[model samples]
Target: MAAAAATNVGNTWINIGIFAAFVAVTLIIVFSVSRQNKTAADFYAGGRNFTGAQNGTAIAGDYLSAASFLGIAGAIAVNGYDGFLYSIGFLVAWLVALLLVAELLRNTGKFTMADVLSFRLKQRPIRMAAALSTLAVVFFYLLAQMAGAGGLVALLLGITDKAGQGLVIAVVGGLMILYVLVGGMKGTTWVQIIKAALLILGAGVMTFWVLANFGFNLSAVMQEAVNMAGENGEAILEPGLQYGASAVSQLDFLSLALALVLGTAGLPHVLMRFYTVPSAKEARRSVVVAIWLIGIFYLFTLVLGYGAAALVGPETILAAPGGQNSAAPLLAFELGGEILLGIIAAVAFATILAVVAGLTITAATSFAHDIYASIIKKGQVAPDGEVRVARWTVVVIGIIAIIGGIFANGQNIAFLVALAFCVAAAANLPTIIYSLFWKRFNTSGALWSIYGGLISTIVLIIFSPVVSGKPADPVTGLSKSMVTDPSIDFHWFPLDNPGIVTIPLAFLLGIVGTFLSKERSHPEKYAEMEVRSLTGAGAEKAVAH
Candidate 1:
């Protein structure tokens, strides 16, 4: 017992040491690049100097949050083949971004999503609408990251209770704020580049180790998972374990897929990355690069997920503090012992830090560039003042995230992230699609799409099973769930996700609102918007630092 205790102590210190090293390196990068971020352009879009490959790497880093690295693996560990559906949805989503949105966004927008929406429409109302939608999506996404950060810290660092989780969250929030305020986009982009490389490397190492354990035979790994899963082994290789086998379940699956596919194009932070490149061609190249990298990374997730089931055991994973979120880290411990586990844990922490920092910068940019500089100051704020407001905005956002994280400590990270995607798809996506493609899309249509989609998503989510209740226990009149309290039993919306209903409603309202309004259509402006969006004619140029 004493020997085992000593070993545990040593492992904890090793993990702490590795985590500190990652933090130190990240801080050094931030301090070094921060000096160059003197102007709003440098702070917001990295002075438009990033190559397609660098921006692609940064995009991959931002997209693969803690939920992707740990939660997806845990879901696979717990639910079998059904968890892999998320992998498919996430990877396919990038194709949508690449084909449809990337180049157009790069050509048309400068700093925020508002810039795109306000291009041919009325500036004030459209900017306000864009700002609201951006903040809404960022809020939910940030909440998920913070909650996941707290839970992962407590689980890996052996913090036993809520107080410890809160402290961990506070520390994470502080670090994220510092990264954004000091480094801006230039600093945040480099941090993301480094984190992305480490994440891919760590996941690749684990995959190779898992494959070697099974003699490099994929079938052997699946067979082992089946065998270890016991009675549920056969089901583990098939669908229905996670979403179930019913009509409603099928609809839910479609909704989730729709949100994951369309949502990527609408994410404000992801969209903002397009502006960091010099031209529409570079944006196109970046998405292609991102597709390959993210595709390969997600493929590795399949191996890691099933490997955890086969090697770590589902029962043991379920018993861990973060449940499915603990699967990848636990697999690391099982495969390579203390040292590998420590390194993997540090990588996971870095993943959370990089992602949260990206989100904060986007949110700050929306507040400063869209709301403060454009709307309130009417584009009159000095460059330095705009950057100052952005930094202060980061502080405010970080505090809100910390408080929200404390309240949302035990929530499922994957589910919260899914909700964010649903909201993004329902609200922001229709606005973007219409603004870019539809000539008759007026300010009223844009407002309706943004406000309609945003409000409807929030309302539907409130009534959805995710918030109100899960299916009741027939015998005990209670739910056996851990994520949400079953106190309010009025969950009339059959689906947990709000995408199916809200997405269509948003599009419908945008069209109907356009027809109902007497606003004049700008045919000449549409022609100009089209030329710029397609060919990058008169698009914003990169300024030298």
Candidate 2:
């Protein structure tokens, strides 16, 4: 597949410069945006001020990341029909967000999920639970991004030495923390806006070139994958034999697909991003933009997926610049050589930076807005102070995320992604949906939903086979600390993703708990939910442009 040894010096310098620019540009945006805030609304929600297009780009910035770029492509390289399943799951999950939660969320919550739940419930446990759940979701999502960014940045910079990647990620962690500190929501939104445009544009260019080379032929690539044996893994396109995965055995390809698609709407980090925008209508339009952008990006990914399998072979994924996750990055290099390769790497790193910033701020805001302002203060805090406290919380949360990434560096960390989706489904979505749509939903029901889902999902994953198998240790090459002698024979969980079990349990718990409680349906509240969510009643009249 290759004749020239890759010095990668050109790619490295270009990446460093781009990474530096993203940090500077992101901070400047955040700073300029931050200066506009006189109230907490401006700080946290941009004073309900984002335009439809700006919100749309922000949605793209929040949703896509290394997991989408690197993880999905690698899965395609390794797992056949099941790989495409992720795209279906991710794209469809947005429908659940768009059709069901969007307007209700806008109408019900002001700054946080707790705002919606507490709209009806007494405040004590509601704010605390919502904040905690949001934090947990943010922590895991942030860890995955930082871990990915540092790893890729190191490889792009030609510092593949283990210590080198760690240093690179630490720098990424610093940049993200500053992004939140200086820019707050305003700055973060702009960073997301620019990054989203670049990411989609870059992917579009690569896909165009690739398609031109292949006569726009999708079928040719799939056939090539079937025949090609990938790099280090010698991974053939055959379904049954991926690094010793079963004939989709206990874990059927269908369930794998289900976890990914169903998992999207449930992600707390993704959903919380909607709160930053002003209204339900804006949220709807934003989803349309995200779907359009994400859909196009994914279409391009299919090209990279097949291109890698066709040109590089699946085994070559292991040796590509960024490890197995390098499939997409390597595909860029394969298609356009060094200059295009540098641009792709920069865009890929921006994808990581922007996504993590969203995760960090979402977590910190939930903690401050929901937990501190709502629960602790009982709606009594000054808006300016609330914004200040949130800024500080961002610093604290950033430290926690950075620490987690360092501890977990050099590991596959792919499983962390699935775990995040599972948690989002279990903890955040159920409580959110019931509070908005179900009239019978009460405070007790909301609490139980959040906690019950959170506890069960986390407990299940810790003891699951991926963790239990004591799978390969990323650092020591020793067995995983969770278990010894990993095996498929004594499988505990039915499948890897807990969505099949946990998502349903989350819904059941919320509904059953609501029905059991005295139905405290405020007539006005129910009317309001219906108006805000289903129709555009109470909508602000648009100013003539």
Steric overlap count per candidate: 0, 12
Candidate 1 versus the native: TM-score? Answer: 0.96
Q: Taking the tens digit of each residue's C-alpha lDDT, what string does model 1 give over 352-450?
A: 899999999999999999999999999998989999999899999999999999998877666678888987888888989899999999999988889
How do the residues 381-428 of candidate 2 rate in per-residue lDDT, one tens digit apiece?
A: 988888888888888877877777777776556667777877778877
Name the runs in model 2 displaced over 4 angstroms. 1-10, 230-256, 470-491, 518-521, 532-545
Worst 10 residues of 2 by lDDT: 1-10
Clashes counted in candidate 1 amount to 0
Per-model TM-score on C-alpha atoms: 0.96, 0.90
Model 1 regions more than 4 Å off: 1-10, 471-487
